[model samples]
Target chain A: MSELWFYILAGMTVAAATGVVMLPNPVHSALSLVATLFLVAIHYASLDAHLVAALQIIVYAGAIMVLFLFVIMLLNLQTDPDESPMNATAAIAAGAALAIAAVLGRVFYAFGTSGAGAELPEGFGTTKALARVLFREHTVAFELTSLLLLVAVVGAVVLAQRDKHDARVEPVEPVEPVETEGQG
Target chain B: MMEPLATPAHYLVLSAIIFCIGALGMVVRRNLIVMFMSVELMLNAANLAFIALANRLGNMDGQTIVFFVMTVAAAEAAIGLAVILALFRNKPTVQADEIGLLKW
Candidate 1:
């Protein structure tokens, strides 16, 4: 039963990831990315990393993707007809690399043993273990992350304001009407 | 106690495939938002590898690092989208080829 569920979640993750790349429209891509993140959270859950799974949902699917949606809506950006297609040379190269890598991966895995041991420590996925490490062992890094978020928020506000200023300035330039031959 | 059909290598290989797909998307797509989403996909793929290795090694540190990575990724998305929004306001387009003011 667990194996069946794992396969299902894995399929969802792969499908969403593909959608994110294949969708032509940016909004659709962002939406599919949200689905992918959610599926990743489920994968984490299936792996018994419950805390990471919960944070994955709350932080990524909840907050970050919402910011993406908000920006997309704010811009009201429509698909431009002038957009170029994906580069053929890059696509071929990437495809070949992926094929080779996949083959190598299969070869490596064929030699790996399924009997490799994995004994998770008690409270491995508990919030207590996470907080203990985060606050005690990684306190400096935790503080730094918060500082980084603060800088990002301020930078976003500054950037948005500058754009608004630019918008106002663009309209201030006087438009000169062109004289037609009939008028002359 | 239970039988394991797939090993850690299986998960690692799967993660690598996903990561390659994300890399391809990042390289081939011209739209800035799509590129950003592809980057996020790559990060998630890395997270998968981290968790798999952590589980195999019987440690929780990788999961803890995944937490930090997710936080940084969120912050990155915020800043990237904000910059994209600003750029769009000036150019009214998000195509990577056209955004070349800084080119020397």
Candidate 2:
């Protein structure tokens, strides 16, 4: 039953992710990304990481994607025309690289069978277990991640405000010239 | 019953296919936003693989890593969209080829 759920969620995730990339409209892509994130949350649930699953939905599907939608609306962007032709050389190169990487990944997985005998620690899926390690062993890295998020938020606000300044400044010059002409 | 639905190998293969599709999308799409979505797809594919491996190994570390990845991905989306907005302000378009100002 769990395995069945895994496959079902995986299918949903892949489909939504494909939509995210294939949809021409940014709004649609953002919506599909939300769906994808939801499916990923389901996948996490199947893995018994309920807290992570909840966080995935809350942080990604809820908060972050809402920000994406806000930006899309703020920009009032139009769909891009299909003007650029595909670069055949780059396509071929990328394909070759993917194939090489896939082969290498398979080889590496096959040879590095070191963790086969390892066992999951007790209470592995419990919030207590996660918090213990997070606060004790990985505390510094965890704090650093929060700092990174803070920087990202500040950076986004600054970038968005910069454009507002440009919008305010650009129209004023044209209006001033018209007023001077009218006075003359 | 029903052969346990499917095995880890099945999930692994599916993850690979999904990853490949993401790679194809990244290569083929000309829109910057679409490219960003494709990159997210690739990251999700990696996450799937990690989960499957974690399941097979019976560990929670993979789940922890996934948590960390989700945080980073959110941050990435914020920063990336800002950059996109900045680029659109300058170029007025998000098409990849139209963005050639820095090209020499």
Candidate 3:
């Protein structure tokens, strides 16, 4: 775990995260999110969570991001090109959110050292180690997660199913009288 | 001030900053889709904070929780976007401010 790498990766993650928020285009925002997720996955790896790093890429960067992009395309969400996004109300809300974050950061800053200060146990974040805890200790929760995913799939399909928007339609084009060439 | 070495504090501050950015996005953006993306970013920031603490604690549980969070986020995104699509299909717009048919 190199400290230098931690700085680089964490910096990249924050920058990409900012881009996700600040970018005007939803597609760019999603791409920025992809970068942030990748950097964060690398951050997890540096933190010794190799399995998490891999899953982060697969589940988030791979699947979820594609979903976002698909939705953006499906809806054809408008891309805002205006340089300024902050209306008066939005500015106030941004200020309030920043203040809250400042307070939280200050609270954490008061404790300079990591509170836990526990040295890593061997095999702490390996796939095998995590699988044991997940499948054995948290079996019920794991199964529930699968159930949740199933429900989400069914719900998505039910919600997103396309049907006729309206029944009223009048033919605008002049219908040419059908020439009965072969009909008896 | 630039620390020569990376500290948990640095990571925490970064996490906090990103979380706030996500919050700002949520509040400032009119588009429901962008709002949803902001929520995802906030979730990511939370994940970062968790992993940082887990690293400090040397706990496997945090990583495990991250797994669950990822799963839940996936499910949430699926359902939420589907809901958004449904709304758009009915109303033909994604702007949060415009879809106020029931509001009195």
DockQ of each: 0.45, 0.38, 0.48
**Top-down lDDT ranking:** 3, 1, 2
Cα deviation at A78, candidate 3, in Å, is: 2.6
Give a tens-digit lDDT track for model 2, residues A1-184.
Answer: 6676666877787788767766777788889988887886666566556677788788877887787788778878667656232467556845774685577457545633434534556665567867876787788889999999999899888775665766698778889988899999
Just chain B of model 3: what TM-score?
0.92
For residues A34-130, could you state the per-residue lDDT of candidate 1 as single tens digits? 9988887766765667889898899888998888888778878677565444567666857775786588567645633356657777777678877
Q: Model 2 in CAPRI terms: which quality?
A: acceptable
Clashing pairs in 3: none
> Candidate 1, overall lDDT?
0.77
Compared with the true structure, model 2 gives a TM-score of 0.77
Top candidate on DockQ is 3
Query: What fnat does each of the candidate structures reach?
Result: 0.51, 0.36, 0.70
Which 10 successive residues of model 1 chain B have the least lDDT summed?
B1-10
Name the better of 1 and 3 by DockQ: 3
CAPRI verdict (incorrect, acceptable, medium, high) for model 3: acceptable
Scored against the native two-chain complex, candidate 3 gets a DockQ of: 0.48
Candidate 1: how large is its RMSD?
8.4
In model 1, the runs with Cα more than 4 Å from the true position are A81-87, A90-94, A100-115, A163-184, B1-6
lDDT of each: 0.77, 0.72, 0.81
> Which lDDT value does model 3 have at B97?
82
